[model samples]
Target chain A: MIETDQLTRCYGHLTAVDALSIRVEPGQVLGLLGPNGAGKSTAMRMIAGFLIPTSGTARVCGYDVAREPLKAKRALGYLPEGAPSYGEMTVREFLQFIVRMRGLKADAAYRRFDEVVQRLQLEDVLGLCIDTLSKGLRRRVGLAQAILHDPPVLMLDEPTDGLDPNQKHAVRQLIDTMARERTILISTHLLEEVHALCNRVVIIARGKLLADATPAELEQRSRYHGAVSFSAPGSGMSQEMLGRLPQVASIEVDPLDGRITVFPKVGERILEPVERLLREQGLEVSEIQLERGRLDEVFRQITTQETDGARDAVAGVNA
Target chain B: MSPIAAVMRRELRSYFVTPVAYVFLVIFLVLAGTLTFYAGDFYEREQADLQPFFVMHPWLYLILVPAITMRMWAEEAKGGTLELLLTLPLTLWQAMLGKFLAAWLFIGLALGLTFPIWITVDYLGAPDNGVIAAGYLGSWLMAGTFIAIGACLSALTRSQVVAFILTALVCVLLILAGQPQVLDFFQGALPRKLVHAIAHLSMLQHFDAISRGVLDVRDLLYFLISMIGWLIAGVLLLDLKRTR
Candidate 1:
């Protein structure tokens, strides 16, 4: 388990992280979502015991990070931002150094070493120096070192920041397999990654927690939730006709592609009514989708509101 | 293995992988040989001891020890591995000590490789082998002091060049503290007791005493205490930087 209470860090007058409290229970993959410079990496560093917070506390497996750093650090594995490692050492040597630093014994270290190497598909490049590897392979080596000890909690900062699509899929799959037994916290700006891997999501902006909810709950806050969209070529569809339905709230047409999207009234279903209307009009729709919710839209809405809110507060003070 | 040992092994191995170790070793050996023979006038002095060799260590180490230790923490900070190493289940002291020991050992290996001088003296005259061994021990101890100073300064910045320059500047001040020129300049301005205390703080004074075949407990303690003091300062600096 990982828990932090009111963890804050400040540089001079600028507060990088502010009163951020979060909890990640066992077997839960928590996605920390934020835009650039949102203090995601700073928060992770404090939790990992690399930086001391200006106030409050972080704990891993019941050990307070500041009070019992060794115990807390031993119980957690952190892949720092940019996945930094010794570039001069070979992948095998660097991993071996990590295993040794973890104080694993001879036989157990060997077993864990082989298991992590094989799991990360790092056996082929074990002898290659980290500096010579491509960005994707270097990230794999960083991941291998972080998981070499098999700690119960893992924190990865931008784990897939520079990987190709195939490598991203492979890494996501690995995290999926490991998610069953470990409490993993991954920070990313990629909304698709939150949907693909996270069971719980926390959004932060300007170093403060903006919203904490599951992926579906966050999507529900979006305007696109429960909306039906379809494309029809050269078909006559009137906004007034769709507005006549009791379940319909509004309609939007794509100026470029002529794709029409019908939004539902609050807590109402409009897919059936929209289908009936399309059939009655003898309109042939090419493709259709009922969006559970658009996460990107929700993410933008939540984060931008926080920024605007801060801007207004500054304006209020100025006035 | 313990965390300190693990860190030390990795650090020592990394030195070999880069050209820093080879370059430092070659330069140190060549300088020591040249200074002992030509600069110290060993052939003309007809000395039966390695005084010519031992006397040049403080000056030689002022430039070279920083070269070995400048990258100790500066590279880690620049490369972002400082976060990786600090987050491991080890205290800052362990990492600092491990890096110091590795650099000190590398210097010791370079010092050891100069045994051909000892053989040359032995072949030429009946030299005092016991005194030569004491000189070697004293030289190694003094190198430890320089390594500690360099490592501490390395932790103060992310640029190796800055670390190297700062360490060299500090080492020069410490080595010159006991020189007659500095002391004479200070004698008229400062009180006698303060000048005496400043001389005592000079690494050159203590090292000179030990290298002259006198194994004073005070001289050994001076090196040990200074090494520990500088290492503690380094650990504190690392902690201070973390919060910054």
Candidate 2:
């Protein structure tokens, strides 16, 4: 539903968003994962037609953002960061205003307004002033305004930023449910958020996307960090000896129970190799299991974000 | 155009949606009434016209117009919703004209409330209602000029303070352009042709003509061109910064 072609935005000398192109499909939640200053928000802004790219261009629903912004914007609903809204207005007033701007019929507008307020549980606050509400409540109202028109594409920047845990859960659920009919591109630093709701992850660091894949697939792709752990008799096999064994890359002694933990790199079957090595060495293995990298672990590793190499690689891929 | 009107409705509604309109009207009425009866020396001078009341408009608008427009696009930018508005299927001109016309209509409403003064003038004596009407047109047109400057300045910064000061400064220059002291200052600096061209651009020259019961097309075009010029500048600034 949205596509960028070598999109680069420079704020004077600072390249806020490098030549990074990404495509989000309909009925999918694409999480734009990146650290602070990673240009994820900038990318989302450009696609939303709020910020023009310094070079290249973006399109929404087949309309070029620079050349035909109105056409593209017709298919877009943008939830900008900071959630700045007309605070003096009531929740209902704000949504109705947006509905009117979208040119929705009065009856249809109110119905859509009611639907959003009900779905986001904003009915109680509909009559309340936006400035009086807490941050979480305010965010709910902001999100409500965004989806009032039911646009085909949504570009949400830090959608769940200030919400409480329950609100976050509800918001994520609403986003996930809404993703069934709309294309969504979310820019957030939270990996759990992406894992829980996003169908595709775009990991960007320093204005580049490092990894873009499914939750499980990203974990599997970074499978080099898998490890096996088991308890063995200390009388025969020492943890030091296990580390020296072939295919057992390294061994760590569990301080509490003295169990041996082993990590093996690629081309090594961790479980079988550890089990055989322990038995041959006269050690009675009590328990054995292999643990691949968790999603969070892979996220931290892949988006470790040190040098510009990976950012360049991702930018190259996007281009 | 419907979208533009829709935006205008909301923008105009925003002024009245809060206490802004009521407060603005009260302030305008109290100031206008005070200028008419006491400070303007209207009763003592025994003039059966609204000359004293409208004489303060160009100065009043230097402060009031910015109050209305300082938050126009700057607030949207600061709030991060400029992206949402820009991405909407409205052209740059639509948004600009929508916002400008909304403010213009609002200034018109505030100008409308001065009808009591017109009524008061008729009550006391047989005032020339035609000249009074011309005066009203002239004041509203000048308000448009101030609003255009305000609209342009508002787009340059997110802070209302900057917008206010810059708009007031620019409006002051426009007002002072044809003043005797200003003319003397410029006469030594440039040739007569340039001075005449600059004098024609002076708000005092055109607005004073209409205030004296002359609704010349030249004066009307001055206000419209100035309005469109600043509106265009506002549109360009907004279009440049259009993004999420």
Candidate 3:
């Protein structure tokens, strides 16, 4: 498990990670979501023992990162931001070096190296110098190094930044296979990644965590009322007057076309009235649909700090 | 032992892979050999001691040691491998000591390749082998001082060029402090005790004394203290940087 008690890192006048207190349990994949410079990297570095927190402390398993650094470091496998593997070494040599540095021995060591190499699909570049590999291949090498020792906690910063779609799927699958045995904390800004891999998400902005919740809960909050949109032909009066009905909560019109989005109050169904109004107005609608709130929608709402404008993490709590 | 030896072995092997180190070793041997034969008048006098070659080592080390130590930490930081290294099980002091010792040994190997001079001098005349041994011991000790200070400076910057230049400037000051001409001015202008104390801090006095077949306890202690002291300072600098 990874836990922090009001952890923060300050550099000169800027606060990188501001009093972040969180708990990441074992066998769970926690996605740390934030924009660039959201203090995600700083928090991960502190947990990895690469950067010391200016205040508070981070613990890995039960060991404090600062006070029991070796034990903390030993419990964690960190792929730092930018994926720093030795450029001078070949893939095989670098993996071997990490194995030794972590104090693993013999059969167990070779097997561990083999497992990471296979999982990361790094066999093709095993003989090439790490610096000579492509960005995607080098990322695999970095992943290989991080998992070489099989530490209980894996702190991966942008683990799939340079990977192709196929490679990305494979890596996500790899993480899924291993999540049952380790606590993985991945810091990425992408919403789909959280939807695809993580069960829980923590949204941080400008050095502070804004929200943390499951993807489904976030999506549920995006809907303030029922919205059902579809194509219909109006034969009578205007569609705008139809919205004047008591059942309508909101009507967001797409000005260029006749497309309209209608939201009613909680537990209210405005679709039947809207459908009847569209028929009476004699209006032809090509397409109409409700906004399906995914993790991306929730992320947008949080990054813009538009709490009132949308819902997810906070909306769920209020509900 | 495992940690130190592990780091030291890799550092020593690195010299063979890079052109700069190979070139350094060849040039060092050539210069040491040429100085022994041409400057010392070895062919004419059949000298027994290695004083001529040893006398020039302090100057040689001023340039060579920095070249060897400059990339120790600076390269690691610049390449972003310092993060990988710092996160390893080894402590900063252990890594620093290992790298410094490895560089020292590489320099020692380059110096040892000039063994033909010892053979030539011993073959021609009855040279005091003990003095030749002492000269080597002193030269190695002197190189230790340069390596220690250079390693400390290496940890101060990410640019190897900056580390090299800083170490070279500090080395020049040490070399000049004990010069006869500098002493003449200091004798007239400064207090005797202060002047002598400053001179004693230099590598020259001890290196020169040891090169001349003397086993001075004070000089040996000076080299030991300065070498270890500078290394300790390097560890402290690393800790301070890490905390900040």
Candidate 4:
């Protein structure tokens, strides 16, 4: 388990991370969602015992990071941003070095080494220098080193930031498999990654936590949740007609494709009534489905609102 | 394995993996041989003692030791591997000590490879092997001091060129501190006691003493203290960077 209490870091006068307090229980995969420069990396560095926190402290597996750094670090696996490794070393040499540094006994080290190599499909590149590997392969090597000791807590910063779709899927699959038995914290700006891997999401912007909830709960905050959207090629479905329904709260039309969306009032189900109206109108609907909610929309709304609120406060102060 | 030993093994292996080890060895051997025979006039001196060879080590190390230590921390910082290494389950001092020991042993290897010169000297005349051994120990200790200084400065920046230049500049000053002309220039302006203290700080003074077969405890202590001082400074600088 990972826990932080009022953890804060300041750069001169600017508070990069502001009194952040969070806890991740065992078997939870927490996704730290934030914009660029949102202090996700800074927070992880503190927890990993790489950077000293300005105030408060972090604990990994019941070890306080600041007071018991080696103990805390021993219980954690951290992959710094950009997955830096000694480029001159072959994959085998680098892994061997890590195994030694981690103090794994020879027999168990060899066993774990072989298992990780096979799991990551790294047998083909074991002898190749890390400098010669592609970005995706480098990322895999970085992951391999982190898990070499099989620590209880793992922290990865933007693990899939620069990968292709297929590579992203593969990495997510690896994380999903590992999530069952470990407490993992990964930071990314990619919203889909949250749904795909994270059991809990913490969203922050400008170094401040704005929301912390499960993926489903976050999606529910979006206005599109429970709303039905349909694309009709030539039907004249007026917005006023849909808005007049007792269950409907508002209607939106996509000008580009003429797809209409009808939002239901709170705790109301309008799918049946909306479908009935579409059938009665004999509309040639090409496609229709209910949105679980758009994560991108929620992300944007939550982040922008904070900035806008700050701007308004500044304006009020100036006025 | 101990963490320090593990780090040292990896660092030493990396030196061999790249052309750094071979290139440095060749350059060091060629330069040491050329300077001893040509500049020191080993043949004309008719001295079986490796006095000529030992005298050139300070100048040789001034140029070469920095070459080895310049990338010690600079490359790690530049390539972003410093973060990866530090986050591992090891202390900062362990990593620093590991890197320093690796570089020291590597230089020791280069010094050891000069045994052909020893064989040549022995074949030529009856030279005191005990004095030669002392010279070798002093030279290796001096190289350790140079490496510690260079490694400390390397931690101050991410640029290898900057680290090399700064280390060379500082080493040159330390080498010149005991020169007669330099001391004379400061003789009138500074007090006699202060001048004497400054001269004592010169690496050449202690190195010359040891190379001459006088293995004074003070001379050995000087080299040990200088290496320790520089390494401690390096650890502090790394910790400062983390807080900053």
Most accurate candidate by TM-score: 1
- Give the per-residue lDDT digits (tens) of candidate 4, residues A46-66: 999888999988999999998
Where model 3 places Cα greater than 4 Å from the true spot, the runs are: A223-248, A251-264, A267-291, A306-319
User: TM-score rank, highest first?
Assistant: 1, 4, 2, 3
Tens-place lDDT per residue, model 2, B106-148, is: 9899899878888888999999888889999998989888888
lDDT (Cα, tens digit) per residue for candidate 1, span B116-163: 999999999999898899999999999999999999999999999999
Name the lDDT value of residue B217 in candidate 3. 97
Cα lDDT for residue A272, model 2?
78
Per candidate, chain B TM-score?
A: 0.98, 0.95, 0.95, 0.99
Each candidate's interface RMSD, rounded to one decimal? 0.6, 2.9, 2.0, 0.7
> Model 2's lDDT to the true fold?
0.81
Q: Given candidate 4, what's the lDDT at residue B74?
A: 95
In angstroms, how far off is B139's CA in candidate 4?
Answer: 0.4
Superposed by TM-score, candidate 4 places the C-alpha of residue A13 at a distance from the truth, in angstroms, of: 1.9
lDDT of 3 at A75: 86
Better of 2 and 4 by TM-score: 4
For residues A1-319, write the lDDT of model 1, one tens digit per residue.
Answer: 9999999999999899999999999999999999999999999999999999999999998999999999999999999999999999999999999998999988999999999999889999999999999999989888998898998999999999899999999999999999998999999999999989999999998899999999999999988999999988766645567789999998888998878888999999889988888788887888878979899988888889999998999999999
Lowest summed lDDT window (length 10), candidate 4 chain A: A233-242
lDDT of 4 by residue, B1-244 (tens): 9999999999999999999999999999999999999998999999889999999999999999999999999999999899999999899999999999999999999999999989999999999999999999999999999999998999999999999999999999999999999999999999999999989999999999999999999999999999999999999999999999
